[model samples]
Target: MNLFVVKLSLCFLLFSKITFGQETLEYKLNIGDNLIITQVATQEIVQNMNGSKHEMLNNLECDFNLIVTAKTDSSYVINFSFKRLKIKTMSNIYGELMNVDTSTELKEGNFEAKMFAGLTNSVLKMEMLKTGKIVKITGTEAMIKKMVNKTGIEDEFTKELMFEAIKKEYGNESLSRSFEQMTYCYPEKKVSVGDQWTNNFSGNLIAKNTWTLKEINKSIILSGKSNISMNSQEESYVMKLKGTQETEIIANKKSGFPELITVTSNTQGTSITDQMGKLEIPTTIKSKTIYKTKKYVQ
Candidate 1:
């Protein structure tokens, strides 16, 4: 059922006609709105170390609830919670193979074995401006501890470090990108039905985006391109990384909330370290991510 919706969205994007309204429109969120978002992804990576090849395949799904909890003069306080998560990973290294699968599902009798453990229970309270920018994220150390303990992690230091890492990086890379893709929909000013606007977020990771309003269909379309490049050299080793991504988003015209988002990315990197200094390892990664809003209120 969800897959069918995704395909229909693609067809709509390709065949939808454009219309222009006489007046400018405001596409902003209101108080008391709730958005139920789901993310599904698949990825593959290949690494070449000297003459040996290693490959990994990953599949992941996550569910989130975004609720508007409060309103201010220029911004809104939103509560975001991770409701469920499932992940599967398989790898082949030099002819040896490994696989891992985990899900945070609650069962009648098997609670301990089915929990996602460290992530499905965490919540991030965010302050978002009317223009769709996230200005703050409230911390939740206690929540992280609950997840770590539920997952059977015994080390206190490891749990503490895990919480700190999530606070700094906002969960895994894929999760962070999911929120980033939604926040990128904010336009600076009012726009007509056919007007196009550009928004960008720049830092260690950079993104350039363009958004168009489809007035007749009452949908907003967004397209984006992003890249990252890093290089480091020391007396003992050298490393280099490069990656690029493209994204498409379809959003609700009245509320500026994303309905469907698709992202495709590729990364390639090289690394050499320590006594392995003479050996050069090259890695290539390709990924596809899709986020769909299952239930949304405008």
Candidate 2:
């Protein structure tokens, strides 16, 4: 009887150890690793402008690749390039505003197509820590130059203007902050299942996020909630919004690369525009985004 009780206690202890083990969730990437990532986002925007309701629907699909170029003891150098981009937008006020596909032949004099075509063949260099912190990103200036040149504008003044305009959205700082949302999800120390951590993102959109490790199996399941604020400015308009977002991620166990991610958010605020004598319009936006990643090693 005593031997049977001792064996039962040993089994319970082993089960407890397996269920409560701590894990270091850092990227374990190797050189020559390639990751193909696809992102799809859909947004619905509603605005009350001059006592009239206006609605717009926008869908964006993008494909990009990341290659591990060099690895240090603590960091990795990666090359990132866009493979394709597609956008479709519809507005109740303007009907179909844009429909562009970079994978297909670009139509002559199509401004949207010409603008997005610049993203192809341009590579950006990124330095990231094993802990998933993006240290620095380079090559945005060259990318902006390529994009402006692809527009085929003749006048230098016009090109300069276009360069500045594109820089607002695709600048080095902007890209770094935008990509950090994907990479900056790891804890500084090891954690076990049910453990939670916090991270923050700053850019045009700011988010204070809380991440929880929900499950640890063949793949890790993580869930996140964020309080988001948006403050963006353009030549003609300034937008301020506040909202919350929920995110779910399923990641590869070995490499810590996310296999799938989904995010949903809703924001409400006002857009102040200078186009017509400084009007402040009430606006709301609901968005859903999904990311899928595939890995290849050569």
Candidate 3:
């Protein structure tokens, strides 16, 4: 009876260690650390209008870099810049709509090329907390000006119009909101395997995300599920959508930066257009996105 009791206690101790071991996860980077992240995304959109189905395809690929320039006890100041940008779009109705690659020489009169090229030269400065929250972002005004100048539009009014249009998507507020979806995944407290937490993202897309720590080994594995809603309006149309997204991430244990991340989402809703006499056209979109990151040395 004594032997049995001792063995049972030993088993309980082992089980507790395996189940409740906690680890702190946060960004741990030093000044001069450079991280290069490449993202690839593919999207398919289907719309039913006037009893006909139309489909569009979009493919996007880009490389961005983050360099830690300064660090405080609680936060890091980083510089973010786009290294390359490429986009391709096609539709059943329009065939090939636009293709732009910043790596290649731009065509003289290609507006899309001129517009996207500007991103490669612009840098955004951000102050990010060690807990993965972005507290402040600057340089959007200069970035927008550079983008507009790349277009070579001589009229000040045209440049102003372009600047405002671009600001909706690339302004300081917009960038902070968009980047939070990636940077705001960490919890304030320590976590063990199988622990779960919740966060949120808001912008053109609003998502409530639930994340789980699946495993901790050579690399940490995390998974997430998000319930998303989107609302977008332009001069002539408005889009409303609801969807679900699934995400998987492999993150470096030391730096807390993602090594690889993948996400899949499906959304469906309606498009209301003035041209359609306020008709509600059924629309659906499916997308897959992948991000790969590595520390750059040199």
TM-score of 1: 0.72
lDDT of 2 by residue, 1-298 (tens): 6999999999999988976698888888999999999999999999997789999999999999999999999889999998999999999999999999999998987988998899877999999988788888899899889888888888999999999988878888888888888878888888899999998989888999999999989998999999999999987889999999999999888898888999999999998888767878899999999999965565
lDDT of 1: 0.67
lDDT of each: 0.67, 0.90, 0.89
Task: Name the lDDT value of residue 219 in candidate 2.
Answer: 93
Ranking by lDDT: 2, 3, 1
TM-score of each: 0.72, 0.92, 0.92
Comparing candidate 1 with candidate 2, which one achieves the higher TM-score? 2
lDDT value for model 2: 0.90
Model 3 Cα lDDT, one tens digit per residue, 1-298 = 6999999999999988865798887888889989999999999999998788889999999998999999999889999998899999999998989999999999998898998899895889999988778887899989888889999899999999999999988899888887777777788888898899988888898999999999989988999999999999988999999999999989888888888999899999999999989999999999999999956542
Candidate 1 ranges with C-alpha deviation above 4 Å: 1-27, 94-115, 153-155, 165-168, 171-178, 192-197, 202-204, 210-216, 229-240, 271-280
For model 3 the local lDDT of residue 83 reads 89
